[model samples]
Target: MTPVFQPGQTVVRREIMRGEPWIAMPQVCVQDDGDLLVTYTPGGTPMVYPETGAFPVGEHPWKLAGSTSWRGHGRLELHWTGVEHSIFLFWDGPQRAFQGWYFNLEDAPRRTPIGFDTLDHELDVWWAADAETYEFKDVVEFEETGPARYPGRMEQIRAEGDRIARLLDAGELWWDKAWADWAPDPSWQARTMPDGWATVPFEAR
Candidate 1:
């Protein structure tokens, strides 16, 4: 927790699925104020793994996606202390237009020497820029992976999703247009991984 990172410093933000490394990738640190850590990855950043070689694509990627060239939209991740969910803003294209808000339901982010680790609790809530139309993203994936991923946390995951929905209904939430309008430094545009990104163990707190 004492390790401090500078803006543009590269670190590995790994997902600890089933207590082992699932997906790892390099992210440029935007800020780290102990409580709120912000990081971003340009579109097309490479995905790394603790183990070398190809990772097979599965039916449920959120469960276990293969290590391919990351074809997803460029994203900025907001990790606040002790929050049940983290907000990720996604954008694509040359204009880097605002896309949508993805509320990822996960355990509290566990700080690590490299960066942060968290077990992504399958079910998530997402809304477009309008925020008027919202939908749960991975119900099918959750049904298939939740029980096996974490034995007793499925009910808690459902409750957390409901809680977020309630807040969205009341218009009470942490992020808004301000966060959505963020733009990254042009210098951080390179799609690369850090020094130890592939070997940083997915140690859960």
Candidate 2:
């Protein structure tokens, strides 16, 4: 059974494949409506990424080689139930200046005993800080490494990008500029992953 999170509660988000976590981030939950989960992590939050020096980023997560702190913008992650992708709203600096939106195309998040797990598709879309201009990100990474990594799902991933592009074009999904004003609670401290975060059981993408 999945546990419900209260506002301001810290939960771990993990990227998993084949029963191992590739990366982990400790995020503070802002809202949970059963269908969607809104979470936040301020800039400088300690996080972990898959450690791959010569190989691609996702190549070695369980190893926890790329331990680093979240930088630049604090992200409000929007994870919709069963959706293939999640959107992130970014704010930078001490004043919490709103940056923009990021469409992270990935596998749908699966609720876990602790938090949630998903796989990054390597393709993403981004809107400028003012929301005036937009562009697709990680296209080359997706094209170069995706086909070989995801097997026959290359087209599926590209199609997901197309789907997100259409949403951006239609101004749907996290397109609201009002979210720019959203800020993390002042009393909240930077969240870090749990001691056994990587040990969290993977539920498959």
lDDT of each: 0.75, 0.76
Identify the candidate with maximal lDDT. 2
Q: What is the C-alpha RMSD of each candidate to the true structure, in Å?
A: 3.3, 3.4
How do all models score by TM-score? 0.85, 0.84
Model 1 lDDT per residue over 1-205, tens place: 3566789987677776655666667788888788778888776777665554333332226335454555655678888888878888888777878888899998777777888787678789999886666899989989887787767888888998999999888888776458778888878864566676646555543
Model 1 quality (TM-score)? 0.85
**Model 2 residue-pair collision total:** 0
On residues 104-160, what C-alpha lDDT tens digit does candidate 2 reach at each position? 988887887778888888799898786575899989978887765677788988898
Model 1 spans with C-alpha error above 4 angstroms: 52-67, 195-202
Error of 2 at 16 (Å): 0.9
Candidate 1 residue-wise lDDT at 192: 68
How far out, in Å, is residue 173 in model 1?
A: 2.1
Give the range where candidate 2 is weakest over 10 consecutive residues by summed lDDT: 53-62
